[model samples]
Target: MQKYWILSLALCSAPLVSAQSLMVTSFDSIAYVNSHNGIQASAHISVKNTSASVKDYRLLRSRIGTTGLVDSNYFCWDLCYPIWVNQSQGTVTIAPGATANDFSGYAYVRDTSANGQDSIWYTFVNTSDANDSLQVMVVYAFNRYVSNSESSLPLLSVYPQPALAGQRIYGIPTDALKLEWMDLAGRVHQVITQNDGSITAPSAQGIWILRAYFQNGIRTTRVLLR
Candidate 1:
């Protein structure tokens, strides 16, 4: 039998305005665990005010969920907690054309089974205007293997350590379905399909993360771009 668990966050109030001008600069969509002890999943999210004026916003509310376990009460003993911001009350101001310093949320889950699932969500609203807001959510799948011998996924490798601007390739499983290249800022620079099979480094020289999606699971690795 397989077990499932969930952790989530929600907004306490709805935005007053019908239109939102805030944009999420970057986000992470997947997390994983390989043991019964569980793991913490987090993402640094950045927001920008495209509007001409400054905007005031705050993290309104949050929630966490866990399910399909023998002891639900065990999660409360420090394994789970709510998302938070650096500000006093999760409030901040963003100037036009400027990006807010990274804000992040994290969740921890422990699974006794080989397979488990969880999720996290965050809601931000414009306190001054009500119309400008952003919601960030990430889903996590936990995999617990008895031993390294039980794993069958092929190793994923990226070549040209410190790849040049125009030369890069990911040595992935033949069954790979999609590839995503993301920069440090969390912006997705490119998406490649199996038909294309092209791996191009970002224009800027720095560190980048590559995500490979296969029929069985997903793999993420970092590479340096020269």
Candidate 2:
């Protein structure tokens, strides 16, 4: 999806090399994203064969760091693999100078208690030669914060009606599940969780619409920042 392109390539970059065969395109060079937990977030990308000869390509996954808080992450090329599997189970044939956009990545976070963030590298390799490969890196983020713009319940209270930017506001709910600061149009600007006892105002000056999530329902309040 286009969301994937928006979050791409600062995490993964490589200098030019000779005899390139595989090239990945149509997605951001580096990407970062924040999505809801317990649901699958997917990104689709295309690969082209820059070589003059036909190339059989297979997908592979390489992790740069630990997979913390993420329940499972997988990729699909010719076939979708289970979470325990890292590479494609099958291969796809690409003609010389042809491109294919059949690669999709999936990630799932099973709970909201812990925030999940994973950086993964996906590569397309020539089946005949391991040296011929193209790789891209993407960062997936899912935090304990959840957003509900339509809740009518009074979830949390803002201590100061007129607070300064970056000022911490108290009176958070005891049973609060998550917190988000949004604009009047309901666009989330910042996310605050239990680790952050009270949410702080952003540097932007305006009427900050603070929303809180709870077991029963969501609540909303407003705080003016100078």
Q: Which ten residues in a row have the lowest lDDT in candidate 2?
A: 1-10
Tens-place lDDT per residue, model 2, 1-226, is: 1111123343345332233886765664543333542234456676788889998988877654476644466665786565567777689999999988767665554554645466667777788988877777766656545442332444355677688988877777667778777664334567777735566788988887665666654455667899
Which parts of model 1 have CA positions greater than 4 angstroms off? 1-19, 36-38, 66-88, 112-114, 146-226
Q: List the residue pairs that clash in candidate 2.
A: 7-30, 7-31, 7-32, 8-30, 8-31, 9-29, 9-30
Off by over 4 Å in 2: 1-19, 29-38, 144-226
Model 2 TM: 0.53
Question: How well is each residue in 79-140 modelled by candidate 1, as lDDT tens digits?
Answer: 12223321225367789878874364433333556465544444567778655566655444
Task: Say which candidate scores most in lDDT.
Answer: 2
lDDT of 1 at 175: 69
Using Cα atoms with residue i matched to residue i, what is each candidate's TM-score against the true structure? Answer: 0.44, 0.53
